[model samples]
Target: MVDFEKEAIIENLSKVINTKLTEKANKFVTADVREFGFIGDGLVSDTAAVQKALDYCESLGGGEVIFPKKQKVKLSKAGYRSIWTWNTKTKLNRAYALLIPSNVTVNFNECELIANNEGADVINLIENKNASVDLTKDSNIEIKNVTINQSIDIDTFAYNSMDSCAVCFQNIDGLVLDNVKVLNTYGYGMRIIKASNIEFRNKIQIDKCLGCNIRLGWQTFIVDKVNINLLVCSDSSNRLTANAVQGNTLHMNACSDFVIKEFRQTTSNPNKYVGSVNINNNCSNVYLGKVYSIDTGFKIQDYSSDGSNQPYNIVIEDMYTEGILDRPLFYIMGEGTKINNLRCKNIGHFWINNGKYTQFGRAILEKSSFVVKGNLPKEVHFDKLYLYNSSAAFQSNGGQDVVTIKDLTIKWDETTNTGSYLKLLDIQCKFMNIGSIVHKLEGSMKDGGNQKGGILSCSTENTLTKIGNIIDQNGVKTENVVVTLSTGMSTMINLAASNIWRDSWLNVLDVELVPVDLTSSIVIYNSFIADTNGQSLKINHSKAKGMEQFRLIVKGYKHIKE
Candidate 1:
């Protein structure tokens, strides 16, 4: 019941369609250097000829530019030394290396743009003096599978002697770089300035560069799957002062909504590398993940000097650091910067210098926050915090907006010989929440060693509320531990507690503690007290109520007969 003539016609039409598709695929252009008047062997430095081939492909509306396998295309001085000075009008023709106009696609696979000189650079993209590429007012550009072996000394180029940036993209949109590797650059590896919707991919190694690895300026950029390797070395014998690498491994300035992932920095020297990553100067909407520093850590500062509505909406999570020295894992000077999840081990110091504007900043240290304070902030917030071998864990001078200390673990190693565990002076924060504590104080009393212990402070105009368990595993007697609460010009001092200990000294003066103000009550149940000389709970100006429920159990105590 089939139409045999119709079936034969359909079969013949299918064969003809298949033949035409094959012909189109075979006719597609594949650029080779030899086809474009490249006569010498592949080892010869024929970058001009190679660029000419690339330009021809671009003129024909974009295609793949292929290189011979296992062969090198050495870039000569004429090809690599081209510099586009800023503020000057320059015309790049199709005769050069594929002048990528707006909305053009240039793909390079199995090709290598190697440096002619063993130590020289391979590609140079200079910004004109007018601060724009002047790409005939075009925006869409894309590049892939390209390798740029940057020059080691870019100062020799007079046009771009001031700031040598390897790959500079300005005033462009929808630019994508994938599977690209840039090595041995004298200046910054890659710079994306004033660009929008830019995406770059894996293996960005800025090894032994004179400047920072990357710089982001005034652009909403998102960097995904980034692996940054910054190795900066210096020899003292050569009278070389190891200048701390200026700029950050990844620096953000005046930009917004920036997300960086898998950021890692490995350096041999600590002092030489300053600030693994810096977020400052009114940059907002930032997200960081898996930030690891092998030898040197990071510093996050807020530079809102003009008071331009301090940067907000910042999150740093899953941070792992090791072998750090004289640097803080997290430093927040901006307002409302939150650190949710962190894991740090074998670090030198962690500091939060809120500068003069201490009343507006907020920091949440969770999962073990440790530090030794050379200079402290006026106010701070700590939750689930831990300290080890650190001289002073909580040190603040007062005038804080808020201070919350919860679930603290302090361990004094035998190596640390100076300062106490906690120190607070003239604090004027609105609320102070302290809960759950374990203090292990160990030292010899031979040479003024036991003079320093835990929770040594002078405070005023703040609430002192304590709840939950307190365990003291110290070898010596717990003495000289004082908590003084007084009032400043403004707010009254409030104190409330339940089931608390008196093993340390507690002095409350010039304050009021009411039940209504203590709705979120501090409940302490079944505790022990072992104060040797100091009073357990000293109430001077006892105007307010709420301290009648504390039960103190004392053991092995010899009180001096008054």
Candidate 2:
């Protein structure tokens, strides 16, 4: 009877605890904007009511600020108040319509926001307390399922602040922007600066932003640890004709440890834009997966304010490009960049500037080519590259320490060939090594063209070697001369006069003498052979029959200094 009484007391205490927990869970309330005097009609301005709803939600220890489903919120103008600054040094004044607080989730519920031709950001993550900005003040904020549209009356929209964008996230930690779409923005679509531990997920699309589609970081602070799933920047109808100069799809500066997957930048007309992707300043440890660029080029430069930073440790996988006829596909000025599997069409170039340890793997160019210009890299390597009907496979300048090309194939067909010859390789370097070169030619392919069937032309100061029977045509040491020979005549020819034997040690292999004048009798026994005495070649005919002219051909191989 005493054990049964103890069990009844414990069960009675559990019921009281469960009743109090349910009351605490009910306190976590979601604030709707419609209850705070928000009208869902598209004609009325709902900026003031939306701001009030966000402020009230944060006062209740941070909850969801939800909008009416499929509502149209119009933000006509911005109030003149400096709540946030762009950076510490510049301290550019910026105004925002909505400022998100800490530990809050603004869920738009697939609603659309329309902004007028005003110079203001639709949303800013940080709320500057005074005239200063702090990098670690706020945390844990998210904005999802919002579509922003900015309407510009071209003549009235003045270019004001640099941070005027659809959405701005600066100096915040633990942030997320998911399922965001921006269209026809006056400035940039999304401006992210000096933020850490950020994520942009579930497909972000920016269409025809006047400035860069997405701007990340700058010269002051470094953005760290960002992951983006998929982003598509496109101008489908070529309507962005009035942009100033910043038309790049994505621009990143001074970023580190970023992994971006499946980014595509395409336009209907290429002449309307400048470039697609620009990763400038001191970005490092960045890996891009599967990028498709149509009618644009990729650039990585060091255009910092002080010009002291350079990017490194960058890798790109599976890139395809087309319709780039004005510039090269890639103009890189950084180090330790490796691109794997590049497929390109149309016509363009590929250049590297003062880079080190750059490599390319498995590239196929159809009606296109690759040329390296500017200050060459320190070390560059290529493996398994195929060029089909390309004008020139390699036209490289500058001097590299070590350049290796393995399994290079050049193909030409009758349907695409313009009856013009192709230049295989022309390079000047310190050390060059080639594994093999195979030509697949069909239908009216000539063994000897305007270049006289010369496939390789290279000049190296140190060492040059080609595997198998590939010979350097610029270093071939063969010369044929005609000299009139009397009974006992001796002539000295300067070996240095010939360009092929200028700095090379001549080793004579074979000598042939053919009589140019057939009417004169010739004596082979009395004819003297030609020999070199380390400086010049000496030829003598001791007992010839008459003054018969004979042609002398000397064939040998050249040996350069080690």
Candidate 3:
């Protein structure tokens, strides 16, 4: 067995990187596009010249294909066509400017490629014809420091041709994208599918992509290890008029073992349907380090059937979101997920549904709430949760085994206008242990709405002493507690009737007497347990002293649920 946390998975992934592609492109034979009849005068069509140069490099068994850095490369859609056929007999005719071969490096050398409106993708990755469709994976391909402008007028572009992109990678291995900037793409900026061992380095900037800025493996094969650094997604208009659009900053499906160091989504007006970072289908083992989102949030869900391919083992650290007041900041529905250090400005919710061993630790939500829904597994823990000026709403469906919170704190700085902040609804758990709660809200906690069964043990300071029936230290469903009562001659302490299993019996563990206003030494013999029942305890004094205050202590046990 391999320990993924202890071992350097990035280093092991680096071992599979094809460094020989760069070595051969830089240190070996090279073919400049100008030498192969490419005139960079910005008037003639350079598509044929670039293709000839690529063919010349492939003939040399793998070499460098370079364009001039001083001049601009203009590719026109003359007669080059690529056809993609679907299972439903739908054909898509795309005009790709150039086709790249394997075992070669194309260095634009910071030169920009101005593509025409009909040119779908600036460079072709996979061959999609009728009889000669290429499903074979391309090896050792690297494109670096290139800027591409599809120059598609979004108003006139065909909506059925939404598959257009700046670069598309399908069935490829060992690819690297360095300092790639794509502007005003009609469709996706980059579409990656069935590709492995890829590295997106330096800065990847995509502006005004009507579709998702970067799309990976949507209804396609499984992808692996797509590590990115310093990603930036922005829309110039801040809105899109396309009716059919995947309006997400980054959407991934069926991808695994990926790490994104940093991501920034600057679109002020994002679509309401999708999230900023949408991880759908069966993506697992993903680590998102830091995210700064505006007007959007994050979502992780598994759309598989019969629980066969549920996503698991995901982690997100240090997330800051704003302008998402109607939806939750983190909408999670998977197992073994952890979110830490979440700080949000406006009020939102954190929704958790149908998961096991999930944790939300060390979160400072100023005006946000936590909501638990649907059926959950046995072990779900929330540790170090702090809420300020927000409601604590935990809603459960039914029949949850256990949910534990280590340290829960709720505080308010205002002195007025505080309503019911703690609302627990329909919580049916066997053992829900919330350890050490400090609540400073104004009103009392609303009663648990229609709880079915089980115990909720919460230690509090001022607002509420207990939320549900108390469970003792030895895993017993006992309401045995020590409370201080000040009464005159006799007082009745009502026992919570929620201890339904042991309602027929009662026991007095110990008794202590303490006088408040008298100088006389009050002893235990002076007081006596006048009467006791399954629902109440009555303690009385032997002497007929009118309105004399004294203290009482008691303890007991009940049946334990196995």
Per-residue lDDT tens digits for candidate 2, residues 1-562, read 0011222223442353234222321123588998998997878888888878777867886677898898888876545444344455555655556777766778898988877444344333223212224534555677789887766432244554445667777766656778988877655777777776676779888886666778888777567677778888875221343545366788899897777777898875566554468888888777777889887777777664333576776777788877655453666666667778878777476656555556778877776756654444367677877777554433335554566778777666534344454454554555555565666554344443333222444454434433322222333444555655555556455654532232122223234567776643353523333343445555564565456666656433232324
Off by over 4 Å in 2: 1-28, 83-88, 118-132, 153-162, 236-245, 304-308, 324-328, 391-398, 414-422, 442-454, 459-465, 468-562
On lDDT, the stronger of 1 and 3 is 3
List lDDT for all candidates, in order.
0.44, 0.61, 0.58
Question: In candidate 1, what are the lDDT values of residues 1-562, reduced to their tens digit?
Answer: 1111323323443354334322321223557767876533536766667666656755665455555553445665443223332224453221112234444444555355555543323344322112244433334455556666554542232222334455666555445565665554544566666554554545444544455566666423322112122222211010111433253555666555544445676664455444356666666555554566665546656564433444455555556666545343555555545555565655555555553222211222222344322233334555665555443343333433445556666555454444543341222343454555566755531235654444433234344533344556653332222223233211121112322333333332111232222421343222223233233333333322333322222222211112
Clashes of 2: 0
Instruction: Name the regions of candidate 3 deviating beyond 4 angstroms.
Output: 1-8, 17-27, 39-44, 78-92, 119-134, 153-158, 236-244, 270-275, 324-329, 347-349, 376-379, 399-401, 413-431, 442-562
Displacement of residue 124 (Cα, Å) in model 3 is 6.8
Question: How well does each candidate superpose onto the true structure, as a TM-score?
Answer: 0.64, 0.72, 0.72
What lDDT does model 3 reach? 0.58
Best by lDDT: 2
Clashing pairs in 3: none
lDDT of 1: 0.44
Clash count, predicted structure 1: 13
Q: Sort the candidates on TM-score, descending order.
A: 3, 2, 1
| Residue clash pairs of candidate 2 | none
Using TM-score as the measure, name the better of candidate 1 and candidate 3. 3
